[model samples]
Target: MKQITILVPDGQSTLSSVACIVGAYEVLMSANAYWKDVGRDEPFNIILAGVSKKAAFDNGLLTVKTQANIADISQTHLIIIPSLIRDFQEATKGNKLLRDWIAQQYQNGAELASMCTGTFMLASAGLLDGKNCATHWSAADTFRNLFPKVKLQPEKLITDENGIYTNGGGYSFLNLMIYLVEKYYDRQTAIYCSKIFQIEIDRQSQSAFTIFTGQKLHGDEMVQQAQAYIESQLHEKISVEDLSARFAVGRRNFDRRFIKATGNTPLEYTQRVKIESAKKALETTRKNINEVMYEVGYADIKAFREVFRKITGMSPLEYRAKYNKEAIV
Candidate 1:
C-alpha cells in the first residue's frame, strides 16, 4: 500500500487542517475498502502525522490525536499539507520544525500536496520557490511580495509540478483531493468519492469566483492617487495621459510605477476597476447589458463586452444569470 501521510501543524492547527487531514483519511479509506470489496487493489495506507502527539485546534476547542509524530515517519510516498487559517504567517512563527520536516520529506523522495493557504507553508519550506503554485486570490499580493520567484496562479484551482501540488483557496481542497484520487486510483473511484462527499469534481478554475478588489496596499501615494481618481471617475473615460498629467509624472515613469505597485498597467487597472463595478451592478441591480456598459463609461458595446469577458471569463449576461436571477432579462 502507498503511504499517504497527512501532515497537520501541531503548533497552530486550524480547524481546516484537522478536518482536511481527517476527511482525506475517511474518503480514501472508503475508496480503498470499496475497491477491495469490488476485487480491486488497496491503493493507500492513510496516516495522520503531526509535529506533536496531540494538537489543539480553534484555541483549544478540540485536540487531535496524531497517528505518528512527523519525525517517526522518515519516508512516505506522499505528504498532504492542510491549510492553516487565513494568515499563514500567524501559524508559521513556531512552525520551523514542521517546515524543515516537510523539506526533508520532499528531499527523501516524497511528493508534496498543499491546500489553499497551506501553499504558504510549502513556499516557506522553499519547495515552491521556482514552481507554479495556487493559493487564495485574496493572498495574491502578499504571496507575490513574499515569494517573488514562485509563479502565483490564483485563478488555477490546482497546479501540478514534478511532484509538488497546490490548489486554490477554501473548500476547493475537496476537489483537489478528488483530483488526487483520480490520479492515484481511477477516475471512476474519484467519481464515487465525489458523489459520496457531494463535491463537484474536475473544477479547474477559481477565476469566476474572484472579485477583483484593485490592489492598493503597496503604499505608493502617487499610484494610490491615480487609482482613487480612476475609481472616482468610473462614469468618465480614463486615459493614462490624463492620469500622468494630473499626477505631474511622466507617462513612462507613471506606467512603470503603476505596474510595479499594482501589478497592472494604467489601462489594465482602469479596465479591471470598471469591470468590477459592472459586475456589482449586474449582480445587485436591474440593468440591461448596454445600460450597464454605458454607466461604466464604455460607449462601445463590443469593447465593453470584450473587456468584461476578458477579465471575468464570461459575458455580462452570463455573469448576471449566474449571480442574480432577479436581474436576468
Candidate 2:
C-alpha cells in the first residue's frame, strides 16, 4: 500500500480545512473500494499524521484523530499540507515541527501536495524555493512578497512538478485530488471518483473564477495613492507619467515603488483593475460584451477580448455564461 500521509497543522483554518482532509481520505478509501470491486488490491495506506495525535480545528468544533505523529512515521509515499485559514506567517510560525517533518519527508523521496493556502506551509518548509506553485488568487501578491524565491502561478487550479503539487485556493482542492487519483490509480478509477464526487476532473485554471483585487497592504502611502487613483479612474486612460506627476514622484522612482509595493507594474495593475470591473459588470449587469468592455474603458474589441482572455483565461461572454445563471437562461 502507498503510505499517504495528510499533515494536519494545528490552527484555526478556513471552512474547508478539515473538510479537505476528510474529503481526500474518503476519496482514497473509495478508490480502494473500487479496486476491491474490480478484483485489485488496495493502493493507498492513508494516515492523518501531524505533530500531535489530535488536532482541533475551528475552535474545537472538529477534532481530527490522527493515528500517527511526525516521529511515529519515518517515511511515507505522499504528504498533504492542508489549507491554513489564518495569516500565512502566523499559521506557518506555529507549526515549525510539522514544517521540518514535511521537508524531511520530501527529501526522503516522498511526494508533497499542498491544498489551497496549504501552499503557505509548503513554502515555509522551503520546498517551493525555486519551484512554481499555485495558491489562491487573492493571496498571490502576499505569497510573492513573502516567498519571492518561489514562482507563484495563481491562475492555475493545479500545479504538479517534480514531487510537489499545489492547487489553487478554495474548493479547487477537489481538482488537485482527482489529479492525484489519476496518477496513483488509473485514469478509469479517477473518472469513477470524479463522477462519484461530482468534481470537474479536467479544470486547469482558476483565473476565470478569480476577481482581481489589487494588493494594497504594502503600506506605501504614495503607492497606495497611485493605486487608489488608478482604480478611481478605471474608465479613463491613466498613464504612468500622469500618476507619477500627480503623486509628485519621478517616473523611474514611481515605477520602482509601485512594483515594490504591489508586485505588479502600473500598467498591469491598471489593466487588472479595469478587468476586475468588467468581471463584476459581466456577472451582475445585463450589458452585452462590448458594452461591458467599453464600460471598463476598453474601446477596441480585439484588445479588450485579448486582454480579458490573457488575464481571465476566458472571454467575457464565456465568463458570464459560466457564472451568471440568469445570463445562461
Candidate 3:
C-alpha cells in the first residue's frame, strides 16, 4: 500500500486546514473502501504527520493530534500541505522545520501537493522555484511578488508539474483531491469518489471565480496613478499610448514598468478592469449584455465578448446566467 502523509501545518487556518486534510483523507479512504468492496485490496495507508505532536488553532479552541511526527517518518509516497491561513510570512517562518522536511522528502522521491495557500509553504521550501503552480486567485499578486520564479497560474483549477501538484483557492482543493484520486487509483475509482463527494470531476479552470481588483500594492506611484486613472475612466475607451503620454513616460517604458508592477501589460490591465466592471454590472443589474458592454466602453459586441471570455473563462450570457438568478429567469 502507498503511504500518504498529510501534514498538520503548525500555523494554519483552523476550518480551512481541517476541511482540506479531512476532505482529502475521506476521499482517499473512500477510494480504498471502493477497492476493498471489489476484488482488489486497499491501496493506501494515510497518515497525518506534523513537525510537532499537536497543533492548535482558533485561540486553542481546537487541537489536532497528528498520527506521526515528520522526524520519525523518513519516507512517504506523497505529502499533502494544507492551507496556512495566518500571515503567510509568519506562517512560513514558524514552519521552517516542516518546510525543510518537505524539501528533503521531495528529494527522496515523495510527490508533493498543496491545497490553496499551502502553496506558500511549498514555494518557501524552494520546491516550486521554476515549476508551474496555482493558488487562490486572491493571492496571485502576493504569490508572484514572493516567488517570482514560480509560474503562477491563478486561473487554473489545478496545476500538475513533474510530480508536484497544486490547486486554486477555497474548496477548489476538492477538485485537486479528485485529480489525485484519478492518478493514484484509476478513473473508475475517481468517478466513484467524485459521486460520493458530489464534486464536479474534471474541473479545469477557476477563472470565472476570480475577482480582479488590480494589483496595487507594488509601490509604484506612477503605476498607481495610471491604475486609478483606468478605474476612474471606465466609460471612456482608454488607450495605452494616451495613458503613457498623460503620465509623461514613453510608451515602451510605460509598458515595461506597468508589467513589473502589476504583472500585466497596460492593455491587459485595462481590459481586465473593463471586464470586471461588466461582470459586476451583469451580476447586480438588469442590463442586457450589449448594454453592459457599451457601458464598460466596448462599442463592439464581438470584441467585448471575446475579451470577457478570454479573461473569465465564460461568455457574458453564461456568466450572468450562472451568477444572477434574475438573468436565468
* Alpha-carbon TM-score of each model against the true structure: 0.93, 0.93, 0.98
RMSD of each: 1.9, 1.9, 1.1
- Preferred candidate (TM-score higher): 2 or 3: 3
Ordered list by TM-score, greatest first: 3, 1, 2
Q: For candidate 1, which ten residues in a row score worst on lDDT?
A: 85-94
Q: Write the per-residue lDDT of candidate 2 for residues 90-116, one digit (tens) a residue.
A: 888888888888888888999999999
Better-scoring candidate (lDDT), 1 or 3: 3
Q: Per-residue CA lDDT of candidate 1, range 204-297, in tens?
A: 8887788788777789999998998999999999889999999999999999999888878999999989999999999999988988999899
Q: For residue 151, what is the lDDT in candidate 3?
A: 87
Q: Give the TM-score of candidate 1.
A: 0.93
The per-model lDDT (C-alpha) reads 0.86, 0.87, 0.91
Question: What range of 10 consecutive residues in model 3 has the weakest lDDT sum?
Answer: 9-18
Error of 2 at 7 (Å): 1.6
The residue pairs found clashing in candidate 1 are none
Model 1: residues with Cα > 4 Å off, grouped in runs: none
Residue-level lDDT for 206 in candidate 1: 87
